[model samples]
Target: MGEEIGSDHFTQDDFREFGERLARETTLIRKLQDEGGLSDVGPVIGLELEAWLIDHNFFPAPHNQSFLARLGSEMVVAELSRFNIEINTPVEEIAGEGLARMHASISETMRQCASNAHDDVDTVIAIGTLPTLRETDMSLEMMTPSNRYAALNREAMRSRGGAPIVFDIDCCTGAGEDFTTSYQDVMAEAATTSLQLHLQLAADRMRAAYNASLLLSAPLVAISANSPLLFGKPLWHETRIPVFEQALAQPSPHQRVTFGSGYASLDLVEIFEENLELYPVMLPVCADAPDSDFKCLKLHNGTLWRWVRPLVGKSSDGKPHIRIEQRVMPAGPSVLDMMANAAFYFGVVEELAEYIDAATAEVPFEAARANFYAAARHGLGAEIEWFGKNRRRSVVSVLDDLLPMAERGLRRQGMAEHLIDKYLSTIAMRLASKQNGAAWQLAHLERHGDVHRLTADYLAHQKSGLPVHEWAI
Candidate 1:
């Protein structure tokens, strides 16, 4: 999905040709599944962190292009909005100091970005939604000058029957409020940033891994909830969840960005098939050579923004592998906080996957979906239903019982003792203190009575490399 294309406008013939290739690639994927051609490697971890470029006033600075050009590095790249950029980390095995390595990699990369920042740019910060971002800041002019983004804007409007996309999010943070606005472009989606984690799994385990991801979505959101405000109005603990979904609104019953309609019943191919049937080809570039690699199928799959996304990639040995990209967590508060969130995800999913059948059978899929939205709206204060229990449990109680399970799970993965203790302890303290990023932001806003100052303070806290729980109001 991060890849750019030359043309956004496609003819009917282009769609027809793309569809034919998609069907062929789908067949190839199934054959690969049957032949056990998918790599059976151990789990690997990777991360992508999105961030904002801000000026002295703490407002979004639309200078990502100049900053990126001056930086001249592949690790940092342009994002949807000119004010935003993404930093990619090298994939590492999820064991023995891997978490520490990730923390170092991210810290160093962020430092390089800061060093290369433009003169007009005060600093680059990572947060779910920039507290100083205004509705007018999300205009089409802020969008990155790329055909892919432009096409997305055009196609999103076209899908709505040419009606302007209306983004409405109403929730209670401190006081109740509603954020209602209309946009002709998709830049509103850019206001929200994310810290996306990728975990590669063997083909056979892909189904269970993806299903476990869905089951764990709510608890993950609650633990990681960050984007608490949008355009200075307090909303969901992770306001990015709704803001991004509604920003890409279409007139269809199913949305492009979703938690998923149901569990992965049989195999990973089912997901690709759903993509082929349901999603229209937004970027229909003709593949120069479309044999075996399934370039067209991959492109189509990229367009469908499922929260628990199934991705196809090739290994260094040229064997194809499958990875589940967990798209729930928001970017920043701090690098250490981001690493903690990833550890919780890996540990919990690795341990809970053993009970998938029982979990799915006991907790209804609709309840799981509802739990996700509730957690996004309420954060750790949400009441969620667990797998084996019929009674609803507050997220705090759930984490109290679940943190030990995650610790045991990390042990099973041979994760370093010191790394596990450092990261998971952050999560535990956050739950105990009720001071995740969103909580910290809300607390500061109430005390300081100015969002710009809070943002500046947040950046200072991030630079210190302290976890969110330790950040003071």
Candidate 2:
């Protein structure tokens, strides 16, 4: 979805040609995997954070074009909506000071972005959903000026046969009523933002790492829940999940955005094969690149938007590698909080990937799926089935048991103990206080009964560089 196309309209012949190229690329991927051609330069870490630009009035600011022009940084780019922009970090090795360097890079980029947006925009903030954002702010006119977004909206509507995308979400633990609405295009997706973490790994470890991500999704979402209120109504702890899923809803057995069919097997190439068989190509913009690049396949995979997505790319040494894009976590309440979430994910996934085969056998894929929605709905208080146990356990308890394993995983990776502590301690404090971003937002709204004031205070705390756990209600 990042790549742009020449035209929004596609012909039958275009689809045919793109499909042929995609198939050939899939075959090439299999051949490479069988021949041990994938890169072993692993576990590289990177991230993309989608954030909002707000005006002085604390509402969405549609001035990203001017904002990006002023910022003039390659790390910052436009997102689906003008009110949103994505900040990307440089790829680093996940050992020693790698995590700290990521934090530094993002912090510097954010500083520059905030400094550059003094004109039409008030300042930049990173959160799951803006409390003051309204339905009118998500119209097609607010979409970023890009051919890719234009084609996505056009193709998505075509896939649904012109049916309006229906968004129906029930508040699980809030006083707000159930919310139901519809949209004629995919603009509702703009209302939700997230922090997407990337971990590049060797092809041999891809299957285990992918399965570990699926199993860990529940705890990750629960601990990182930052989105609670949408349009003045308190919704799920992390409302971004349902909003993004239903925003692009279509009448197909294979949803464009999904948890996936089941856990992966021995070979990761099976996923690409399934992509070929099940999903219809949304953007048939054929690339003029080599077959080894897998351009068409990559574009098609991008459209799928799996919660845990697999990416194929080349390393600095020019050898192919696979990476897992963890998309469950929201953008943030603070940079420190976001980095802590990344550290927990990296360490835990590394440790669990070592024993994923046995782990998956004990916990069924259906249970993992159930755990995800449960956590998204109820946050830290969510009770999820763990380790094939007949009874469910609170997400907090599950995380407490896993923190030690994560510490061990970081140690095994040769990360400095102090650096590990710096990140993991933030998670510990959040768990102990039970004051994640969602909890803080809900509590503040309850006390003040004002979304605008809630947002204003949230921004103040964010600017103060305090983690959500430390923010006062």
Candidate 3:
């Protein structure tokens, strides 16, 4: 979905050819898995953080076109909306100072992006959803100029038989106040941003890692809940989850954005096989690349925005490898906070993957999915069923146990003790204070009763480079 297509229009013949090519590639993937053709790369991690370009008024500034041009860096690129931009970090092996290197790189890139923005644009801020954004701001005119985005909007509407894209969210404001509206276009999906974490793993370990990511999604969303208010109403703790899921709704048996149908088997290719079977081709932009490239297959898989998606990519040596993308967490309160979230994820997933098979058996797939939504709705206050527990436990308690396991996992990966403490301690403090980004935002709005003032204060604290727990509400 990040890549652009040659054209926004597609014909029946294009879909036919793409389907044929996708089937061939899916079969080839199975053959490769059987032949052990995937790369044996150890744990390598990278991230893409989506952020907003805001004006001095604290509203979204739709100037990413000129912003990217002035910045002149490959690390920063345009997103679904003109006001949004994505910052990518280089891949780092999960050992030694890899986490610190990612932190420094993104921090420098953010500084350069903020400095190079258009005069009308204020500094770029990373959040799940900008608090000052208005509903009228999500028009088709605000979409980033790209053939891929245009085609996606067209096909999504086509799937719904030209019905208006309805975004009806139960803002969960406790007074039965709901945010219900319809969009002629898919710009509503653009309103939500996220921090997508990619972990490149060996073919043999991808399954365990993917399952472990599902098991951990609840606690991760709880601790990192950032998007709370949408269009001035107090919604779920992380309203981005529902905003994204409902914004792209279509009349299909399978949802384009979802947790997943089920856990993965030993053969990770089965996940791609489900893509071939369940999902319809939204963009049929056929490629001339060979079957081994899996261009069409990858493009099709990209359309299915699974919360924890399995990816097939090429290593530096040009060998294809498998990776799991954890897409549950939101973009920031600060770079330090985001990096802490990343460190915790990588460490815990590494340790959990060792016994994910047994863990998943103890917790059913439906329970994991339920836990995810529960956590998204309630943040740290959400209670979830943990493995080997007779009753549900609060997300805070679960993290209390998981943090030590994460430290041990980082130690096993040979990560420096200081770096481990530096990052994981942020998570520790967040749990202790019970003040994630959402909690801070909600508290600020309660005290100040002004969304603009809240956003301004949030950005001020973000620029201070303090974690959300330390930010004064």
lDDT of 1 by residue, 333-415 (tens): 88988999999999988888878878888778898899899899999999988865445888788888879879988899889
| Candidate 3, superposed: residue stretches over 4 Å from native | 173-176
lDDT of each: 0.86, 0.90, 0.89
lDDT of 2 by residue, 264-311 (tens): 986678888899999998889988899998899899888889999888
Task: State every prediction's TM-score relative to the real structure.
Answer: 0.98, 0.98, 0.98
> How does residue 401 of candidate 3 score in lDDT?
91
Q: Candidate 3's residue-wise lDDT over 1-473, tens digit each?
A: 47999999988999999999999999998988889888888789999999999998999999999888888899889999999999999999888999899999989998897787567688898899899889999999999999999999989988999999887777653622678888888898877999999998788888888899999999999999999989878889999999898888878878999998888877679989999998899989888899999898889988989899988889876788878889999999999999999999999998999989888888889999999999999998899988866548888899999999899989998888999999999999999999999999988888898989999999889888999999997
RMSD of each: 1.2, 1.1, 1.1
Clash count for each candidate, listed in order shown: 0, 0, 0
Candidate achieving higher TM-score, 1 or 2 = 2
Model 3 is weakest, by summed lDDT over 10 consecutive residues, at 168-177
Ten contiguous residues with the weakest lDDT in model 1: 386-395
lDDT at residue 42 of model 3 (Cα atoms): 78
